[model samples]
Target: MRPMPHDHSDHPHALLPPDPALRVKALETILTRKGLIDPAALDELIDTYENRIGPKNGARVVARAWADPMFRAALLEDATRVVADLGFYGRQGEHMVVVENTPQQHNMVVCTLCSCYPWPLLGIPPGWYKSDAYRARAVREPRKVLADFGVTLPEGTSVRVWDSTAEVRYLVLPMRPEGTDGLSEDALADLVTRDSMIGTDIPKVPS
Candidate 1:
């Protein structure tokens, strides 16, 4: 729907960062000069993603699934329909797939072809996600990538790398952490991070 999401790494003006902050400012200036966007409105939209409409939405879905076995079953069975029903489908997120990370298996996602991602569910993709280094290394060395993310699994644990395309995007369903037995849905949601849903990390147990 959004012009077949692909890597713009080759674009001369593509935003890659040694200084993402400055790049953002320059892009904003150009767009403003072109009168394509209102700075005030743009700031508001950025604020929405930063504060309100971020991974919090996906966290709610994860939290609900953790608390309700029925919902979890339905989510795993039909991620596209179930997530759309929950109002998390848009653009690159039109085709949703939920891959669960089990005690014996871990799932991580990469867009080897391009940076296709579930933006509606995960909000903005992290800068590292779009880097050529990440897109390339994630598939070739997922365990190493996970370790860089501070996740070291047991030797017996198998890692699965899923590649996203223009047709489909994936969300990793991380296992609920231990010691969350008595926590409410909201409490559990707080423990879910964007990295956890991407399979690079697991939900943290609050101390």
Candidate 2:
């Protein structure tokens, strides 16, 4: 008879009482048998969370910052207070840092060691961002990785790569899009995409 595939029974954590045993076991079974999480289902879950409570809430913060120069200064100086000022507080986001992208200096964020991200402000990261390829390559070769993402930096421009660590998180402040001179706060918030928040894309004025 063919030998049964080696079991993972010897794993130390296998038999240990999970904090939430039933849910943990169900997730493990799905991952083990299927070898992948269902992207569509994950997207649905993300959509539900976003609609219920996600960056759209944070978009209002960005809109307010864009409209108010003093608030923008406060946000750049101390993100936690600015976010708190707008009533968008969380355990993780309580110590936030906002990085502004200017004509001369551009900033991109990544987590080299792990997937440390500001979930309270930007919601769940996209699949590409959490992938090993992106995590490794982004820190090792930031400009090249950004180029692949269709974000070409100007010649002689310096690219700063920030690695998000414990106790500190970052959010990118994309430049104000053109033709938004007199737009309402809600309208501006509608244009603030997650990509803009991550420095992968600039917000665009709706046509």
Candidate 3:
């Protein structure tokens, strides 16, 4: 919805030069010279965020929504509270809005200004999500972006793009795959991918 004020000092970019490319070089030069930061440690931290702490938490939320109608209703009505009920809430996720995907309408989330994603639900924002290309094109040509991610919708389905802001981050509750009626919530969560939760892709169907 609206952009919210955020503290940027903790952001790595805030500590470096304005140019994204030069930032790495600058950080290396400065940190190395001062002996304040270790490259290996930094790499490990990034790896942790990118891999280990990913969208598994969000997948669980989606699984719950799919299994329980009341929880789904509450999630759609008041996402912040519903998600917090599951012990997931912090920073960018303080104010959240959950959009459901349907046969008629599909929803996508993007942050035009900056990467304001729900860390509690989705963890650290992906590299592409914060890239300038994705930030600009996701709003300009969402269908094309989706296509790039190998997601093609039917001609009749309408696409809605939700612009995320620092104030309110949005999450897409992707449609549950068919033939999963007998699957438990944990099993269902295994089918939910990070891209699916972000509306860039769809959930995987059991074979």
Q: Write the per-residue lDDT of candidate 1 for residues 1-207, one digit (tens) a residue.
A: 578666666775664444889888887888899998899998798896788666888899999999999999999999999988988888678889999989899999989887877888998888888889889999999988987899999778899999886688899999999999979999999999989999898899878
Which one is best on TM-score?
A: 1
What candidate 2 gets wrong by more than 4 Å, as runs, is 1-9, 13-50
Q: Please report the candidate that would top lDDT against the real structure.
A: 3
Q: How many backbone clashes does candidate 1 have?
A: 0
Error of 3 at 41 (Å): 12
- Write the candidate numbers in order of decreasing TM-score: 1, 3, 2
Q: What does the lDDT read for residue 193 in candidate 2?
A: 81
Q: What TM-score against the true fold does each predicted structure earn?
A: 0.80, 0.76, 0.78
For every candidate, C-alpha RMSD to the true structure in Å:
5.3, 8.6, 6.1
Cα lDDT of all candidates, in order? 0.88, 0.78, 0.89
Ranked by lDDT, the better of candidates 2 and 3 is 3
Clashing pairs in 3: none
Range of the 10 consecutive residues with the lowest summed lDDT in candidate 3 = 7-16
Instruction: Put the candidates in lDDT order, highest first.
Output: 3, 1, 2
Model 2, 17-128: lDDT tens per residue? 5677775667756676786766567777768566755667667878888899998999999998878777766746768999988888777888878787777777667787
- Candidate 1: stretches off by over 4 Å: 1-44
